[model samples]
Target chain A: EPEVTQTPSHQVTQMGQEVILRCVPISNHLYFYWYRQILGQKVEFLVSFYNNEISEKSEIFDDQFSVERPDGSNFTLKIRSTKLEDSAMYFCASTGTDQETQYFGPGTRLLVL
Target chain B: QKEVEQDPGPLSVPEGAIVSLNCTYSNSAFQYFMWYRQYSRKGPELLMYTYSSGNKEDGRFTAQVDKSSKYISLFIRDSQPSDSATYLCAMGGSSGNQFYFGTGTSLTVIP
Candidate 1:
């Protein structure tokens, strides 16, 4: 079965440094999303992408965060400057259509010091 | 109020026992309900997806949605030790492209 895949299973960065998380969604999926979960907290949606552009974003998706479908298969989330609060597990997901069940990748754990 | 609320249970059960997990939501417009299972240090894996209000069954897993009461549930019968994981309930609506998730309930099935 086709599955979403994310690179760099774990990353550690210093404060004020930049980090980019990458994901390769299922080949036939049309919608991609980024979500994050702070330790002991619920998973929160950050942004949704479709048709090569952002379809929607949450308040947590602020100026420091950006997402891009850099190519046919790669989707990325770049955090300009990492902070202690930015430490969390970031998940990438994809769906064949909007409002459908999404498939999630194993997730990239980011730890900022 | 939070859009979706779930009890964060570290619920433990013996093998072959039945397990029930539940969640409630404040959004009346939510029409899509889903359950996901996540192992420690892993992203959530979709286990069941239901549209509107009804019961959906897949093997030993059953999902129930009550839109009027803003509630949903996942039931696992003849549960095995491998079924131990964190269960999360998520709801989505037409107005939003994102799904609001509940704090997951952790389960441990002892053999």
Candidate 2:
């Protein structure tokens, strides 16, 4: 199976600082998304992007959160200002079409101080 | 109530044991059901996917969905020690882009 790859498997930054997590989705996939799992919690969807625009976002995706498909193959999630609660395992996933299975990248563990 | 509910199990069983993992959902509009396995801090790996209701089997794993009951299940036969991980049940609404995931159930298949 084709795979999605995320950079910086682990990142640690201070509170109030900015951070960007990058992912290289499968070449043919058109829809991309970001989800995060806090310790001992279910994976929650943050946002979904397609056609270079966000299609849907969850409540957890507040003003501090943003997503950008910077180039043809890369999708990124940026936190304008990190908070302590922001620490979690952020997962990037992509799918060929809607209602289909999403393939996930290894994941980027973000640690906000 | 949560849209999706699954038992967070630290279910331990010996190799060759039959394992049953289950989830219950409240929404009737959900059109797709899926199960994923995550190991430690790694991302989820899709193990089985089914549409609507019924059962689908692959090798040692089987997935069943009963839409009328709003219940779904995954059964692993002859479980191996390598199967130890967290299993999450996820459902997709009619819109496809949005999905609801259950708190994963952790399982340890003892050798």
Candidate 3:
């Protein structure tokens, strides 16, 4: 079956540096999302993207966060400046239609020091 | 209060035992319910999906949703060691594409 895939399975960056987490959602998917999980916490929604625009975002998706669908298949989350608290497992998900099942990628583990 | 509530259990059971996992939500607008499984250091994999109220079964796994009570459940029959993982319940509504997830319940099926 086709699945969402992310690059840089794990990343280590300085506290103030910028980081970009990349995802290639299923080719035919129209909606994309980003979610994060702090080590042992519940998965938290970050943002949702559709039609090259943001559809919804959570409080955690503040000024530092931005999402882009620079190409047909690539969906990326960029953090302008990383904070220690920003370290978490970031997952990219995509769904073919509204209210459809969302498929998740393996996730990118971001570690800030 | 948390929008979705779930037990973060490290529930351990022996092989062939049945496993029951559940989650409750405060949002009445949530119309779609789903269950996901995550292995250590990996992303979540979709296990079951349900719309509104009713039961959905896929092989040995069964998903039950009670919209009136705002509760959902996932049951694993004859569980195996490979079933050891964290199970997360997620809910979504018609208004948006985002999903709210509960703290996952970790299960260990020892063979």
DockQ of each: 0.76, 0.83, 0.83
> What total of clashing residue pairs does each candidate reach?
0, 0, 0
After superposing candidate 1 on the true structure, give the runs of residues whose Cα lies further than 4 Å from its correct spot: none
lDDT of 1 by residue, A1-113 (tens): 89999999999999999999999999988889999999899999999998899999999999999999988999999999999999999999998855568889999999999
Q: Write the per-residue lDDT of candidate 1 for residues B1-111, one digit (tens) a residue.
A: 999999998899999999999999998989889999999999999999998999999999999999889999999999999999999999899744799999999999999
Task: In candidate 2, list every pair of residues with a backbone clash.
Answer: none
Tens-digit lDDT track of model 2 for A5-54: 99889999999999999999999999999999998899999998888999
TM, every model:
0.98, 0.98, 0.98
Across B80-108, the per-residue lDDT of candidate 2 in tens digits comes to 99999999999997677877899999999
**Model 3: what TM-score?**
0.98
TM-score of 2: 0.98
lDDT, each prediction: 0.94, 0.94, 0.94
